[model samples]
Target: MKRTIKATFMAAMVGMSALGAEAADYKQNPFTLVYDGAIAKNEPGKVNIHPVTYRLNGLNIAANVYTPANYDPAKKYPAVVVAHPNGGVKEQVAGLYAQRLAEQGYITVAADAAYQGASEGQPRNVDKPANRIEDIHGMADFISQYAGVDQQRLGLLGICGGGGYSLAAAQTDKRFKALATLSMFNSGRVRRNGYVDSQLETILQRLQQASAARAQESAGGEVLYAGDANLTDEQIAKLPFALYRQGYEYYWKTYAHPNSTFKYTMSSLLDLMRFDATNQIELIDKPLLMIAGSKADSLYMSKEAFPKASGTQDKELFLLDGATHIETYWVPEYVDAAMGKLTTFYARTL
Candidate 1:
């Protein structure tokens, strides 16, 4: 009884109470968000952001346009459409990269995924493979019509899961002059096959649970978690999985709004099983840049896609020596290399 009481006391010290529809303090979990990442909007140059909506596969998508600091609004500039990672927003890495690329003299527009963000969709945060791919093509059309954008010189950059979606998009959309993916994740393959082929044991079980959850949803039950974290030490030890730390130190801690905590229905993985980014990589003929960190577990996904790409001469794969997946998203040294390569690629391709 003494030992039991001691364990309870220790647990209480680290336990946190979560309020619904708000930011979660994850430090207690050691792998979750404890603080916030609130960054002031500083568009270095003549950055004009216009909030717009465009139709994507049946969903009305949200997008933000960044015109360069040097933007005259009177002259056309090369344009890049930046896609966010899975479960991310236009205000995250995609937005930062978009704004910076615009500051570097390109017209950059970053868009949120259909249901999860400040966009229109039903049953929010539903991760559908086809919908995501169609959203990319729709984004191309949207950015091409912006006042200072040159549609013919259009390029697309996808980060994390978005990178894979970009590959799916480029397979059919010929308008994308160049393509780039950062820390690209093969969501579909990972979902169906497990990360690095390690967790196949649970695919069937997970699928079964997802099916049951779908039925419950049809019965009008609110979506919730079946196997998510409860801030237990055991949970933290299990995270930092698949090149992702269980936490968001660099992005969320430095750029998150005090009140913004985004989450998805726990069962969204059901559809994720179908979203493979490398199914037809060989179909993409544009200049392709696949950038990843040598240390990332996801690096293999890019390496796999590179060799299968049809545009061997038009493609390049760059690995940052000691960085991890998230580090490349906003870490200065990593971001610089990414921006530098992007600048050069767009200048030549666009």
Candidate 2:
């Protein structure tokens, strides 16, 4: 009996180890930097983005750098690091924001988080928390060394899920003097608990179902992409949540970029529930700016993160009354406000 028990214990230990490896599979890739992806043929005043690679905990993550028109190599300039939304690429709104900011005289770098986009990784779109946080710091280290880059005056901006990582990055890294987000998604709050002040509770069972999804995968099955974007008119009408129609416009058709993957791992949502970037907001110690549509479903996320930030005297939260989540990302009126605040911010902080 004793011998049988020992063998069973060892088997269980091995199983646990394999499980841990799958959970953190993205931590081992090399960081890829594109020093000169496009220098010879960039339109004047247009945001010129180049592929950049950097190292963090030994991963070779990828990024795109957007320099302003007439960027003089001799003069120092402020820079912004943009983190894209979940399941988004460097070519998404993050890149758009970077280009716009660069046009306004700030240097910007929009990066693809590890295991997604063109970045290096296996089992893509895994959505690990540490990988996402590390990607932000890696961008910071890379841009701080550019010829005209001013290391002291740096800022970070995240959209959707990127907003949570930006908050996580600012919590520990002082490199960012100013931080902002558009429709900041509190991934953990939404995962472990339901959306908006715990409105959609009973998330624990959802996770258990995801675990079953992995078992299905282990048995030579296919991955299932959750979320129903193809809802009929009646389905759309039934959704009590606001901004989903707007979400479809941005993520599906309008402003939709080709690089984003329509499906990410259902299992990754497990890690998302455990994520809590806003937990240590009091430790951020920088200027915090939160922007979102007043009617957006994710508005409460921005509001929650802003107040918890410690020594956050320099913070400002902007709510566009009639706007929804996607509106702030690319709409003309909302973009103008963002442009003004962003330019003024780097100008003042840098």
Going through the candidates in order, what is the number of backbone clashes in each?
A: 8, 12
RMSD of each: 7.8, 11.4
- Please report, as a residue range, the 10-residue window in candidate 1 with the lowest summed lDDT: 10-19
Q: What is the number of residue pairs that collide in model 2?
A: 12
Provide the TM-score for each candidate, comma-separated: 0.81, 0.80
lDDT of 2 by residue, 27-116 (tens): 121222111122334666565666778765656777878788877779988899999877667765676688788888888998888877
TM-score of 1: 0.81
Name the lDDT value of residue 286 in candidate 2: 82
Q: For candidate 1, lDDT tens digit of each residue in 1-350?
A: 32232222211111111111144333332212222231234344556566778887677787878777767767989999898776567766787788778767888888877776777887776666777787788888888887878778899998877888899899879999899998887777766666665557777976887778787787889775322223344433344342433233332344343322334444665776656787877888889998888877678888998888875478899988776676676566777888888888888999
